[model samples]
Target: MTYTPPAPAIVDDIVSKTKFDANGLISAIAQDTKGVILMLAWMNADALRETLLTGRVCYWSRSRQSLWRKGETSGQQQHLIEARLDCDMDAVLMIVDQTGVACHTGRRSCFYHGVTPDGLRDTAQPEISTKELYGH
Candidate 1:
């Protein structure tokens, strides 16, 4: 289904209130409608603007120093359902309809490790294989 974005003025108003860090980035967390946390990423102003304008979640790739559109390569697109900012406006919580796995490792979520007495342990298995997702 095609999702329409909010009006430009509304998008601008929302982006304007966001508080990005010194690096011009803010934390963005994506969750499913079921309240399952999917992944955490960063977003610059441009990324935020694009996301709000397009209904597709876009993030900042700190390592690549460019806008990273989710699922661009992995086919695991995250369609924005709703976006909410924290009280401080330093972070955004995005409720999304994920197309596929949300993690590079082909897991349902990026948060797969659990802190245990034996140190971190894998709490979930990958639903899809990385090789099938990335062709590596």
Candidate 2:
């Protein structure tokens, strides 16, 4: 988190030591400083390096076939405070200091929809438009 060594070295060490599943992907959860779940994504080695280099959230876009930089177009950048790998090294927890909205829908967090004790619930609605954020 505090120290981001050169990519090649870090990648080599982690890839060689970390126990990755067959998918070669790691689950990553984004959280605020106060431990609020903001969102979840996947991170490949490339994404990890990108995030460390830029101090922003970077995730692998399986559908898009590319790396997705959080808030690039939406101006909802997450300034990383720390990145922690789980004990098993199969998952990551990203603690960040967010700027603007974290959600593409102009919400503070992406976990707006929730399943409560009563079952599924639409906890919140979009505060702004995707068009406004992405400029379609």
Best by TM-score: 1
| Number of clashing pairs per prediction, in order | 0, 0
**Model 2 lDDT, residue 15, Cα:** 52
Model 1 regions lying over 4 Å from their true place: 1-4
Candidate 1, 39: how far from true, in Å? 0.8
lDDT of 2: 0.78
- What is the C-alpha lDDT profile of model 2 across 1-136, one tens digit per residue? 3435446766567655655567667888989888888888887877877776667788888888788898777887787888788899888888988776677777777888788899888777777778878898
Local distance difference test, per candidate? 0.93, 0.78
Question: Which residue segments of model 2 deviate by more than 4 Å?
Answer: 1-12
As for candidate 1, its clashing pairs are: none
